[model samples]
Target: MKLISWNVNGLRAVLKKDFMTIFNELDADWFCLQETKMQAGQVELDLPGYHQYFNYAERKGYSGTAIFTKHEPLNVTYGMGVPEHDTEGRIITLEYPNFYLMTVYTPNSGGELKRLDYRQQWDKDFLAYTNQLAAKKPLVYCGDLNVAHQEIDLKNDKTNHHNAGFTDEERADFTKQLDSGFIDTFRNLYPDTVTYSWWSYRFHARANNAGWRIDYFVSSRDFKPYIQDAKILTDIMGSDHCPVELVTKDLI
Candidate 1:
């Protein structure tokens, strides 16, 4: 099976762009999105043969996530069971017979590290949640995690070291997540090959290839063997983030 994840930034806005064009071109078995920024009934998507699950933030037009899958899940859950974290609609988990697929939009540690504390709590809780699910079944989780985990993950590493996504606290949490038995699929496949999924809208970043690899498709250790390959579709564009993908056989 083929799976793709992209942070459309805003689903409604991307609809006017070539979103559908790329969607059709990729033709993935599962397509996930982050930062959808819309409430229920705000938009209607006609995706034939795919089941769509969306999680909307209580604060409209804020953080959100959605997943479109050809394979129906045995169960679908909207959050991590924590009221504070669930309020943002940042996560969606789909449980299958043999695996659980999750898409998440991790909270950003805003400018000046204003939300770093909350983000830390989120990381801890989110990691615990995935680990709990992994204990039951192999798992594949992806989306805009909003952290440049390593110096090699961004172009201006030294300059942006302390930035929102590059702060030590944030990067450390990411490391802890991996240490807990999850594999960063793309990095694992292309160890030293540097590629990025997100770019700043300012200073002609994308054109100059000055960006950060903050988006990912991570899987539990048990699911590692099924991961055939991971890709960063940097060429396809609709939002600031390009799509990242994972290919595999029947997960069961």
Candidate 2:
């Protein structure tokens, strides 16, 4: 099965930018989206083949997530058991017979490290949530995780060391999570691929090939054997972020 994740930045804006066409081109079995930034009835999608599940932030036009799947899941869950985290609509899990598909829009630490503390807390909670789910079955955790993870994951590690996504603390948290039993699927498949997903809109970052590998499709260690391939659709347009995809040989 092919599972794709993309941080659309803003669903309404990207829709106007022809996200539907890109979605069609992907033709994935399951698609997860982050930073939807809209509420129910606020936007309409004409995707006929997919079953859409949305988790909107309580605050209008803020952080949010959604999942569009061609195959209906056995069950779907929203949030990470913390009311504080739930309010942001950052996580959504779809449970299939074989594995759990979790999409997360991890909180950004913000400029000047304003929300660093909160972001650390979010990392802790998110890891715990994934661990609990892994106890039941294998997992596919994919989305804009908001961390560069390693120096090679970003274009300019030296300059971005203190940045929100590249901070030592943030990278360490990501490392710890991976050490806990998840594999960064793309990096594992294309170990030498320096491709990235999200890029700054400023200074012609995308045009200059300046970007960060913040988005990911991380699989539980148990799912490693089934991972066929992992890809980043950098050529696709519509959002500042591109789509990250994972293809598994078998669902189980």
Candidate 3:
């Protein structure tokens, strides 16, 4: 089935910018959204044949995520079962008969690394959560993870080396996540492809194609061979980020 993930930046804002048009065009079996930036009741969406699930931050107009799926899940979970991490509404896991699908909006380390420590802790906790889930069944995890894993991921490696998303510590954390046996579907499928989902809103970064490949569709090792395709839909626009998509048959 087709699955797509996009960090809409702000769901409410994107809604006014033809979000529905793209949604209709893509026609994905499942659409996962990150950084929705709105609390409950802030926006109303009409998706005729999809079942919707949303996790909103307690703070209004802040970090949030939602999933729209044509196939209903057997069970759905919000957060990582950790209060500190759950409060941000950064994750949602949907359990099906065969696997678990998780949509995540990883926290940024902040411009000056002010939140680096918390971000590190979050990485550890999220990895642990994924591991536990993997132990139960195969998994497909996707979203804007907010980290550039290597020099090849961003345009100016030397200049961005010390930035929050490209810091040694953050990259190492991402490496650790992959080392734990999850496959980064996109990178694995197109080893030489070098596009990105997110770019700086300032500096006309997206227009210039100066960006980092921070979004992903990572799956458990056992399911890697089933990954039919992984892509970065750079042509689409609504938020600072474009969409990243993945395909596999019988997602359940």
Off by over 4 Å in 3: none
- Looking at model 2, residue 216 earns an lDDT score of 97
Model 1, span 4-87: residue lDDT tens: 999999999999998988898899988999999999999999999999999999998998999999999999999999998999
- Work out how many backbone clashes candidate 1 has: 0
- Tens digit per residue, CA lDDT, model 3, 141-248: 999999989777898889988788999999999999999989899889888878888888889999999988999999989877668998899999889999999988
User: How many residue pairs collide in each prediction?
Assistant: 0, 0, 1
Candidate lDDT scores, in order, read 0.94, 0.92, 0.92
Better candidate number, 1 or 2, judged by TM-score: 1
Tell me the TM-score of each prediction against the true structure.
Answer: 0.99, 0.98, 0.98
Candidate 3, TM-score vs. the true structure?
A: 0.98
Task: Evaluate model 2: give its lDDT.
Answer: 0.92
Off by over 4 Å in 1: none
Q: Report lDDT (Cα) of residue 246, candidate 2.
A: 92
For candidate 1, what is the lDDT?
0.94
Candidate 2 structure quality by residue, lDDT tens digits, 1-252 = 899999999999999898888889889898999999999899878889899999999999999999999888899999999987899999999998988998999999998999999999989988899999988999989999999988889899999998999999999999888899999999888888898998999999999989999999998899898898899999988899999999888673
